[model samples]
Target chain A: MTERADCRASTVSYAAGMLREQLLSPTPVDLRAFLMRALRPRDCLVQVGGLAEVSYHGRAASTAEVGSYLVMIKRDGSLQIHTPKGVKPMNWQPKTDEITAVLEEEQCVLLASRRSPVELVRVTFLEVQMAQALELNEEAGFLLTGSEAQMQETLAAHPELIEPGLRVLNRELLVESGGIDLYAQDAQGRFVVVELKRGRATQDAVSQLGRYVASVQRVVGTGVVRGILAAPSITGPARKELEGRGLEFVEVNALPLVEKRTSQPSLF
Target chain B: MTERADCRASTVSYAAGMLREQLLSPTPVDLRAFLMRALRPRDCLVQVGGLAEVSYHGRAASTAEVGSYLVMIKRDGSLQIHTPKGVKPMNWQPKTDEITAVLEEEQCVLLASRRSPVELVRVTFLEVQMAQALELNEEAGFLLTGSEAQMQETLAAHPELIEPGLRVLNRELLVESGGIDLYAQDAQGRFVVVELKRGRATQDAVSQLGRYVASVQRVVGTGVVRGILAAPSITGPARKELEGRGLEFVEVNALPLVEKRTSQPSLF
Candidate 1:
């Protein structure tokens, strides 16, 4: 590899290390790009916010939804839910690019892709929303409602969804690139990047989001790429300012939930 | 000095250094204990949802104003409008407790108490608020109107109001003990404390303020101290969270120009 490529790889590795530290905490890694290399083939978006949709390659594919279940990898790398839901462990590694396609083909079905076998798990998005709502309230010990065994059952079944989101995000936002937040595709074949704010949205937050928007827009036409600020509720002044600047605000509470599939048998 | 006192002082000095670095960035500080120590003498109350209020020490005596002005000391030690503003200048040393008492009793009216013989200028609070407001909007080249110069001129003229507000703040909140922000009583004896928000009030921002409040409450009783977030319009989940906690929020269009008067001017 060229010196520049090596440098770039090192930088990515460094970022991945930092991210892993943030998630894993005490479990510090010795490798340079542990996350990038390990999670690879699976593209990961770290700390992304203001994303409207995720695109695959050059196409703005509808973001994949496994019912209402929204999975988020926290800053600490540990999985958490704003709602009460169990995340099951699975063995398959779905090809990142094909995960979206698999979700597209079935209302709730599994598919085998070049990357790995994919399974569509039955879950609800409201669970995630509920978890977020509880987070807003700062309640302690908000646990998952389903048993760990059930979550494991789901994870054992639908392993494809986890890495694909990252892959789709990588293609749309030019993953492995240095920048802020995560990248994805919007509805109109545009890149949609998101900047999350758990606190009050300040000018600094807005500007940070604005930077990500600009960066993504440069690659995807400005019109194709849009910014979505995901927050519990924006303050009046912050809302007034960002909305005035034409940034779309998607209140997570107001976000539509993909219908959960109950009758569909579990792939497990 | 007692061993405990010696240890505490060392910790204070250490904390001051850490604060200088953290507050210098646009990123707001996110510690409760640190804020409590930095804004000494004043009490702080951390409410549910991480909302905080920094109560002025002397507010128990006054009740007309909306609340204390959240002010910050810039890294240079100059006062700013945000918390964890920065470090104080190296040469700066706050007055001792004894001096504070003598000065407070004198109501800072006599020209002899103006600690430094700097020129006096008068500045309208509205303009200062405006400057802060614009800066928070990410507007470039934002300057605090010649308020500092104006304050110099005002001090030169009235000289009597040199420490007009000195009595308003409690003696405990003064810099005598190496505090970061100085909360002095204004001429009217109404409690006013400077609150600093390095950036805008996000959830982290509110958390910082919550720490400030918790610190203040430890000294002053509740219901006496009113608070003014005094930033550009606060927005996002932080706003709702702050409001939900009952801390009064004030959007100042400008900041008050504070002049360095040599001696406290006395109308007498």
Candidate 2:
């Protein structure tokens, strides 16, 4: 049965990525066929539940006794086995050189290995209860944000918090297209353009900062201006965009100062 | 597409044990009813998949951004969230005093708390994909074994390997019913009765040793005979049985000496 306690909350996450890759058929023939396909090298994540026996044969050898477990093969060529008892996987191997699966008799056998030092591991699945293979895309499909107006004000009050030896020169300074969040000067006397987001930032925010910096550069010369985007976190694509343009990212967790007396209380 | 490699084998396990535990029905009403059941305190293991936003509100206040994850609540009042990318749980709390689930506006809210330091974790599940809860029974329903006969020879040649100063007096020494694996004398010079098992030892093996020790005790007039069970592993019931009978368990991994040149090769 169960016990009762006050319903407090804890840290948790949700799933959103689309299931674009393989959906498992849960048979050795299907697994062999899937694994024997061309080596396209797309990101892959596989989960299978069954009886497994894992053994490694390299410089040092070790084997785990057989038991039912959830085996995961990640896209980065890493493998892990999760038991029912705890959070940590009962066994795991780091990213490696190669991973292959095949059918022998009615059983599914997986072989993973690394070169140079020559390490190898084999996993045998006696019976599969559930199996799924997913391909992960590095793109974040959703965005979470807070009040940008309040975020700019907070960082305006504490420019040094954004970067040491920085001071705000203007807030909402008008340019040709729109108003910049905060125009500032860096410690090295460089004109620094700052854009702040209360929550997760995206490529649109980065592009805005880049335009602001370009505007300042037109007046102060190209090499005299710097661009920085400050936010609690940023999406993967936004990070890539910032890196490509040689811009900087500063963390600003204080933007969400107002937890919105709006919105209903959370359910679990 | 999948790549090809030589299909070697690794350590794996299979599932057993009757589904004596609870089988879950996914619904707020059902979860509330199940969680509000009597405090029977049977071992519980739960697995739920969905979008979740986890936040901890205690001395160290923290919150994880919303994402998809697997949430696990274990029998001992422990809770964990597993992400898809790695072997470690993204977030976890140790054994706690209470864990409760309730529905608010169709959202499932979980509150888990510990008393001493007064730490609490709150998890809100916006949607549920796959959810199941099963009671974990410690009794292992199956067994694994090795070469018992070979194990006896390995230990006989190296009795000190079992315990320091242990010397074998005889192999398969006869008793009232049958033969003991190894008859030895300890560093203390008391008579020792040893039972050998190649793979996993069970309650039956422990009982056999108990009988042997009693036999030797009757012949030697009590308090002078010690019983030992040697095997690669032992079942949970056998472990409890050994402890209750005041017996010893020794490591004997040499059993499955012949990996059965029989049986077809593994499938995954």
- Candidate lDDT (C-alpha), each: 0.30, 0.64
User: After best superposition, candidate 2 residue A222: deviation in angstroms?
Assistant: 47
lDDT of 2 by residue, B41-74 (tens): 5354665655677776443455666766666776
- Report clashes for each candidate as comma-separated counts: 105, 53
Model 1 lDDT vs. the true structure?
Answer: 0.30
User: Where in model 1 is the C-alpha error above 4 Å?
Assistant: A1-168, A171-178, A253-268, B1-268
* Per-residue C-alpha lDDT of model 1 across residues B1-268, encoded as one tens digit per residue: 2432232222211111111111101111122233333334321111111111221111011011211122322111122111111121111112211111111221211010112422111111110110010000011121223233333333334433433334323322533112213243445544444343423556545544444554555466653443435444566666765676566454432224434556765211
Tens digit per residue, CA lDDT, model 1, A1-268? 2432222222211221111221111011212133233333332322111101211111111122222222232222222111111112111121222221112222211221222222222121111111110011111221122233332233223322222222225422332222444455544545666655543455545555655675566665547666666544677655654675577665432212335569765222
- What is each candidate's DockQ, to 2 decimals? 0.01, 0.03
DockQ, candidate no. 2: 0.03
